[model samples]
Target chain A: MLYIHHSICISPQFTFPEVNLEELVRSTDHKLYAKLIVNPDIPPAMLRRMGKAVKLAVSASGPLLKQYQNLEGIIVGTANGGMEDCIKFLNQIIQYEEGVLTPTNFVQSTPNAIAAQIGFLSKNKGYNITHVHRGLAFENALLDAFMQLDDNPGHTYLVAGIDEISDYNFNIEYLCGYIKKEPVDNVHLYESNTHGSIAGEGVAAFVVNNNQKGAFSCVKALKMLHSTDKDEVEQAFKQFLSENLSDNKTVDLLLSGENGDSRYLDYYRLMEAAVPGAAIGRYKHLSGEYQTSSAFAVWLADYVLRQQQIPELIVKQHSGGNTIRNIVLYTNYQGLQHSFILLSKS
Target chain B: MKVFVTGMGIITSIGDSVESNRKALMEGCCGIGMLKGFSTRYAETLLFGEVKFTNEELRNMAGVNERGVSRTSLLALHAFKQAVSSASLSHEVISDSKTALIVGNTVGGMCLTDELYKDANQRDTGSEYVASYDCGSVGIFLQQKFGMKGIINTINTACSSSANAIMYGTRLIRKGYAKRVIVGGTDSLAKFTINGFNSLHILSSAHCSPFDANRSGLNLGEGAAFLVLESEEVRDNKKVLAEVKGYANTNDAYHPSTLSDTGDGPLLAMTKALEQAGLAPADIDFVNTHGTATENNDEVESRAMISLFNNKVPAFASTKSNVGHTLGASGAVEAVYCILNLLHQEVYPSLNFNAPIAGTGLIPVREYSKAPLDHIMSNSFGFGGNCSSLIFSRV
Candidate 1:
């Protein structure tokens, strides 16, 4: 089993070093951007050059690298990586019309910049990779780390997921009907009878290892699918549960990716029906909606499994579960990339 | 649990098919020249290895009639069709739940940089290309087109993207997650990359001469390549192209855009790959060097090669000299060339080399010749210090 030793998240809520997500920070703006206060420990020289995504990723994983000695690998996932820089570079191109362009923005625009930054800072010479498959990005990164752990049980791995919102991207997505037309309180996000969800972004990182010494949670199984059919999703969920979960106990908490988009409500409804006895919880309202928001969901699941307390603000429906043991996290992006991550108490 | 290559496909400036690429390699034909397909201010100033086709022509060639499909996805579909057909994978087999698709792409729909800029500016109710901007869009398009039901992912580690994809796919098969995997990478020339490389002052004014003392810089290229990898259990009656003996990936952890002078990342990757294959450095018959023609890359790679091979380097050449640097697709394209080298028992020469680097004193194969080959290694190092090496052996 792969154990999550450290989990760090820079979400909209106050979920950084510890889980203090009881208070809800409602946003009046259409985009509920992450409130990631910069870590002062980073050098000013390096901090000035990093984009928001790279900053969040490096800050979240830096402390863990210092705490641990032998990190054998670094894997990261980002759907629309370094969009701010990409947009900046594109604007320079348009302004200059293919003339002299700045290289800094272009250098930071690639998707693997986060992983590379982490590796550079840690001075780690090991297996390093990056995944960018929309919502499945985080899951794919976790799966890659799990496979690495399966190969060498003694090595530690740093896995992270990061994405940042840019004004250009937000405006384009808004025009594409991916974001809500008007601002609404994020606390009441699910009650809005709208076709689109709010836009948000953040970064999350986890230090995973095979040893369960100080692990917060143990990952049981992770599965990803690319399908839009409801029946196929349900069937895959059933198969996944049967293969990973024990016959005696069912899922304790069902963390669903319900981003208040009516088009995808049926997926969450199916997930709710699939896990009848589990307490249903939603995280998109707190974190808003992003491509790799499932990383936040995983971080939240780790918190619940370790702390044994579900935040009342995120609880959609309670099934009288005082002691949380097994949690099933389900997420899908625009009906394209679907993933399921099963976590349990260590 | 051995991973075997069942099929291979590639589309480069030198050729559109594997056979054509092989023929061009044997003849030492250089594809780098003045850009003709796209118009830019640097069109005359800098050299590029652009595929000799327009966007519309590529769309028609790939049989993709859909509007707003990026050139990257078109090239991917074209090469993917070839790979699957060569593998004799039926539609039913390709769409099987046990089949997976992993692609590496650095430039996605951004190839339409002007269109994206206009769309973002006007917000013109968004266009078909709006959703295709991300790196994952290429894989999503392919997955939708082929009705792929298994795991679909995209890796974007710059030039090493496809090499890591191939490595990840092989690991998935070895771990029993997938029975068969279609792994490769695609990248198309765009103003975004051209200006990016140019701004970095790494674009060559002339055709790049890799490993040469006076090598100026690299000529940007565009293309796609795919290889169908299957586990030993699924290799029943399938024609094996080559055996994926070993692979490894390592980060330099020293610099973001350049490698250390010691070439630690490349050395580790080569050593680990050889270790995984249960072979020593001497077992490798030839080496497909990254050889981006940049000063740092050529020198560092030469140092790494000398250190790893213990001063007894094997016959090697950088196909980049012929095809230019294909960025994300370079790794897979070079891997296909390596397979061809093993299959045909031939060594393709590195083009335009007058003198070796000052200290390393390394000389690459200067002429194409037939040689008895058993195992060959391909190296792909990218931005962010991502270095990957793959070794393919005779089956």
Candidate 2:
């Protein structure tokens, strides 16, 4: 019953609106250092208050807030929420002797500040929560919202997953070998034999409600893996297919968090092996990799389900149904934070 | 839907454990004091309800090796150990997959972070001390403390962190994720948070008088509290302290540090929590408010309470008068205070209150009162405009 009324994403690629998804996917050859959402009209004062993740959340959550006048609850997911702002303020305090660090920067440094900012600006307040459990952060928030929706029908919840790449973050990842040294083409992500995948940034939000009004799709099921291996994923995927996807034929499209790490590729390959005839699509090329970027997959699933068309750049095959009906998304962080989400047309 | 508290533990200025806290609350004693835990140049200017225990004292209490864990982790381990033992689930449930540890913390070993900054040779990135700042240390410590490794997590949404942690723990249990969860929050007095709030100029130079006319600002305190939340199946084995009937979280987003003058987010959270409990404003017999004693916080909280009760506000008091603002643990600590109120049918006084504020005519309990209480509402509001209300009913 959790219907995604609206969703928005901001990444290094040009994937802001629905139209930009194709453009972003088509032009994903280069490594994106920082993904700052470009909004020309918003005044500098407002923009200064937002970090990369905050901007993306605002843009995505704005449309949802406009659609629903009252928000019953707000839940946010982030792996490293506002770490950029934290570094900024801490650097100031360490370097400036605690003289006059701007309160604005320090205030937004907290992870939940994004939700608080949205609630304050929209003047909608009911319930607000922030999750920071690495990749499962978004899943936990989604689960909480789904439970809330189930408990109280006919209420809308704003759920957002956000994370940004900071200079410190990039340096640490580089030191830890979490980012790729060699850049590769977007279409050949799985083919690239690299030690690490490119680190990216993004924020995606959904206005979830039980009242499935002119919605494109519904969240069929969400399952997270704690001690999952390739075999576990395969078994879980088969279980999900048999129980939820009763049709048993094939999923229309499969969006995956394929970050080009050979060690992590087995899970996605297992998923591909499960859904034999489904078209395979990868998003880390355009969106890069963050903790909650799987939210982007949910957005993509909703998009293809609503439009009934897959962008040529994302379509690995055309053999599946031309009119998209089902999407199964697989996401993980370093092969540890694995989750499978099933979405289908209403 | 019927989650019961099987065990409770708290460490605060008023008391070090549940029994002492109950005694102090029943006797209506206050624990606020001039800052004596550390040597502060601003010592004359600021008063705090800081825990009197030093790092060595806490380590001796926990019987842990020195220089092994951060002070923050030490305090957390203390409270978490007590809660786990009080629940009697220590040896019996170590391998229980249904048992999880969820902690709410704001400063994750900031004292260690500061020590590293001071001692160049002692600072080692490879050490567990530095890695503890990941905010997972509390969960990791709790896991090792009892040798239980189920669902481990931490909530760090500033002040309302523990309230949200409790909320998520209940939801996870209700959804069958876990059968029992050791859920609570902990924070230690650190130069980092103390200086951080001090830099914001919201730290009071005197005792915090929540909702009082002369209230200037908050007096920062630090401590921990833990409650064992059990599924209905496990509640019968242990005495049910109270039931977490309803809870809600809302964000104000008005300002990063300051709350909105209208208190919209807090009002919504309280109203929704009451509604979820299937109770009206009149049903609440007493209210434990998040009166941080800040100029804006107390006034805004007072306004929210008045608007929610429509001028017929329940008998209320800010236990912060005794413990100061304990940051993230404030929610869970105050929640235990509310449960204690329901159990004993006593209302503790809000100290240093002479007259009500100008516009908001609400008056907190100035002395101890014994009354039959059915339901009590506890409010916890954080700096990020993160507001939460948890309602507890006597079982």
Report chain A TM-scores, every model: 0.97, 0.91
What lDDT does each candidate get?
0.90, 0.77
- What part of the reference interface contacts, as a 0 to 1 fraction, does candidate 1 reproduce? 0.82
What interface Cα RMSD is found for model 1?
1.2
List clashing residue pairs in candidate 2.
A116-B253, A127-B249, A128-B249, A128-B250
Model 1, residue pairs in steric clash:
none
User: Model 1 segments beyond 4 Å from truth?
Assistant: none
Model 1 chain A: which ten-residue window has the lowest total lDDT? A25-34
Q: Candidate 1, residues B1-395: lDDT per residue as tens digits?
A: 89999998889999999999999999999999998877788899999998888888888888887777899999998889999999999999899989999999999988898888877776557777888888898999999998999889999999999999999999999888899999999999998999999999999998899999999999999999999999998878988989999999999988878899999999999999999999999999999999999999999999999999999999889999998999999999999999999889999989999999999899999988999999999999999999999999998
lDDT of 2 by residue, B329-366 (tens): 88889988988898787888888887789988778998
Give me the TM-scores of chain B across the candidates. 0.99, 0.95
lDDT of 1 by residue, A1-346 (tens): 7899998898878887655787887765767677877777788998887888988888788778889868998999998778888988998998989888878889898988889988988889999999998878889999999889988889999998888888887877777788887667687789987888888888889999889898879888999999989889988988889899879878999999999888889888988898888999999888888888989999889988888998888899999767898999999888777899999999
